[model samples]
Target: MLLSHDITILSPALALEDCEFPAIFNFGDSNSDTGGLAASLILPPPPYGETYFHMPAGRFSDGRLIIDFLAKSLGHPFLSAYLDSLGANFSHGANFATGSSTIRLPNRILPAPGGYSPFTLTIQYSQFLQLKNRSQLIRHRGGIFASLMPKEEYFSKALYTFDIGQNDLGEGFFDNQTLQEVNASVPDIMSKFSTNIKKIYDFGARSFWIHNTGPIGCLPYVLATYPSAQKDEVGCAKSYNEVAQHFNHKLRVAIVQLRKDLPLATFTYVDVYSVKYSLYKEPKRYGFELPLVACCGYGGKYNFNSSAECGGTVEVNGSQIFVGSCKRPSARVNWDGIHYTEAAAKFVFDKISTGAFSDPPFPLKQACHRNLD
Candidate 1:
């Protein structure tokens, strides 16, 4: 309840503080997924966590994720996945994110470990709602695991973070929707996103740190998928990135509306697209190389092959081809075809945490205060 306005926080690429946020309740897709997908789905095999954990640590990157960096900055342990039961400690807060998640449930469903996760935003919220109530009971029950659960007050004081919606756009592409159709769907997608924010707001969330969708076209997957798609000056698909920009524009408008709707809450809409795009546009400026290619992918134009993903093996003429990481992951930007490398993730966190890319122009340390303009 009594949060000091102290502006002393640490960054992971710098771990990111004087503990600006007491706790962080994160929601979204793989961009911030700690381990929800791995717990319920296939575990990311070797080399996924080789750069940091030196083992399969349930992260998609070749090291830590942006969420991990954020936790380090706040001086709190990495948030345990709400779905992870093995050795999870949620005393600070919990992550409700998963890989291949969408704001709204997907229309197309494949049987048994489908293309996308069934743990949609709504489902994640339901899980959080359960935790919110159950933690109250657990704290009072006085069990041994009670210490691992979050305190009742942490819910109200924690930083609410979101880094989702990119997958929703990807789903549209997968469904064979035209670019215009995907562009038209942004409003409805954002509507669902806003509704979820309202639900979390009603549940006592006061400080929000939301990241806008990045340049979807910059990813090797998109580039490979739509070989005929238009390209930007930086060799990314221009139309796809435009759609992402459109989404970010609407997301900002939604934040403005949310600020008015929830008078007591502070909303920071972070512009992660610009920061991410810069990585591709100017990799050398940041000590990065091969910005457009995947560091842990197999052979292809972008070092990515969807059939033979990073850390995966495929048979070629009865011989197995092992997909591994590059020699120096720190020198690369993209991790897998779909995710950013830990180095890139760290670079992104350092820039965004400074509040240079946030709405209302407030740094992460000062994000709790409501912005008047």
Candidate 2:
């Protein structure tokens, strides 16, 4: 485990030795997307990843995600998505997250009652497989593992991070599904995701940083969709957030169990819910102005209009519904109905950089320390 402070900054090659920055392989949903699905799939652009990148970077956010912040904080370069191969070097890391993904093995979302095929976790895993193959090529000089390492040392050193399952809750709750049904099904969904994590671990990933769900109840999309519900308490329709919390709790326990099962592996839990909530409580501390209202969207509470979505037009009451946007997005917390603004993400990065690593058996810094006692 090599701590960032242990690393001596010089050149990229020299930095690798000092930092020992493990190859960062991210697997999750749109929350951690760094431009894989958006580049491949056809969708309304211009709204996503627009804050800093000035264009859709495949991320559902208007800017970077937690993964991007983590990579930079760890002294690693920005991670490239598995789908993006243009001038991208897989020596460092790659992202395998897509929008609308779920943790269930064969997950599917009925966006509009069987209107379109939601991007499933299975598809994301397939993309991850593609990334793994590419990384192998880089390590073994064109897929010849024996050439790079002895038979005994074939496994590579990588840090695999997963941030998924919010979409599962979102689809169920927002699509008029029952909370009882979601609660009953969440554990099974987590089990399937855990299996994939275990598979990655078996494939030689020694370091794992898994994120818990965010405050789904606070999302502008949820708040605006259910105006009649009490804001102080969790919305009745969005009660699936509580179910998400249950899943996250189970995930934490599973991670603990996995650590016991694999003593050599280092696992860290990133409590994104707490982090985001802290920022929302005091946006000024993080240089943010509006934490509740989304920067991009048309009129309503939470700055959201159900008929209008990012990057595309919609018809509302026989009128052309155009989603409006803020002039200075840097002052806002949320970029869209579901994602954060670049400023918000930057603020999140600041929190994670500080003490987020201090929560357990393996703080992020401790996990990265090469000379772990």
Error of 2 at 118 (Å): 5.8
User: What would the TM-scores of all predictions be?
Assistant: 0.93, 0.81
* Per-residue lDDT over 1-373 for candidate 2, one digit per residue giving the tens place of the 0 to 100 score: 3565455332222343322455677888777877666655644377666766777666777777778888887777788776665655555667777666677633344344422225555666665666556545555564633232122122255667788888777767765777787677777776777677777766677767778888787788887876765554322223535666787788788887787787777677777777777656777877777777888887776778766777667777987766656888888878887888777777766765554433353345445432233
Which residue pairs in candidate 2 collide? 1-368, 1-369, 1-370, 2-368, 2-369, 2-370
Stretches off by above 4 angstroms in model 2 are: 1-19, 105-119, 134-155, 233-241, 314-322, 361-363, 369-373
The digit string of per-residue lDDT tens for model 1 on 326-355 reads 999999999988999899999999999998
Go through the candidates in order and give the C-alpha RMSD of each one to the true structure: 4.5, 6.2
**Which candidate ranks first by lDDT, i.e. highest?**
1
For candidate 1, which ten residues in a row score worst on lDDT?
A: 7-16
How many pairs collide in each candidate, listed in order? 10, 6
C-alpha lDDT of all candidate models, in order: 0.88, 0.67
